[model samples]
Target: MTAPDPWAGILDPGETVLWQGRPDTRPQWAMLSPQRLTLGVVFIVAAALWGWQSAGLASAGGAMALLPWLAVPLLAVGLFNLAGHVLWDAFRRRCTWYTLTNRRAFIATDIPFRGKRLKSYPINRETILSFDESEPASIGFAFEPVPMKRSTRMKMVGFERIADGQTVFALMRGVQGKIERDFPIDPESLPR
Candidate 1:
């Protein structure tokens, strides 16, 4: 009796819909990962150390040797980490979207010159919720008992820099409440 849901196909057969929205198209690089910031810092430090060392070596090898063989690569690594990541983060924000259903939460992204990808996480009573109350808010999700290696681990998902963030987060909380009320764990089922 209403317009067809764009995300209806990805949902489960009996899943109830909660909320759906596209992330703002504004480019945002401030949300880039901590690892990216660390990488940039490491490169900058490397350039400083190598440049100082190469300067000392210049007296022995001459100015030509230092510039070509040493200083260039150091500068390149530093520039790549700083500028490259900002560009990547901006591109990702532009292509991201978010959806919430009673059964799960989903994020769909399509990077420029790269393909699209969709990831969904089932919502349960135990799923963690963290948020920022700034202008355009952010909600982040993380599941526990993770793998040791960060690269191999499941990264936390987020709805980034979107309007009405608090409203969306409240919807998530309501869905979680419904899950808990419908399927409360029984103490008798556990081994005593």
Candidate 2:
């Protein structure tokens, strides 16, 4: 007897899974670069000073008592910039899972309190692939617009920090090649 399909309802007809993986969950110390370290330290020191100064005013007035509490958020932001961001990223990565199929790539994240999210990007002939050759490499094949305070920015979506990125990158390239071969677009169909 054959084994049951793990992605029976998840996958489309004829679509086969090429690879599945999870990123490294350990704390990524690389996130705390020199720039971030200096900034975090400065912000933390400033917040502490501000809070200390504001504490003395608590005896003078009513609204002045709340001034010290205002530094709490700043301190939190400073902490986040220092090492909290790295820890948060690791936590998020721990909840993330990646799956690559013949037709598409899937990123599934199940963060606590935030909920589960499953996003897929189609791997078509027109898809542009980007490979980051780092120690634990990354393969980016799609872009998702991330909303910022002022505007939205495109963020690369892919298999991040996977051990076997080269293999996955090759598989993605092969998928694109096979798709082009199977479904050739006629040159006569021109928009220009």
- Which numbered prediction scores highest in lDDT against the true structure? 2
The residue ranges of model 2 lying beyond 4 angstroms of the native Cα positions read: 1-6, 59-64, 185-192
Which lDDT tens digits does candidate 1 get at residues 75-126? 6776666666566666677788788888788888887666889889887788
Tell me the alpha-carbon RMSD of every candidate: 6.2, 3.0
lDDT of 2 by residue, 1-192 (tens): 999976889899999999999987888897788888888888899899999999999878889879998888889888998999999999999999999999999999999998999999999889999999996888999898999999999999888899999899999999999999998888889677
Count of backbone clashes, every candidate in sequence: 0, 0
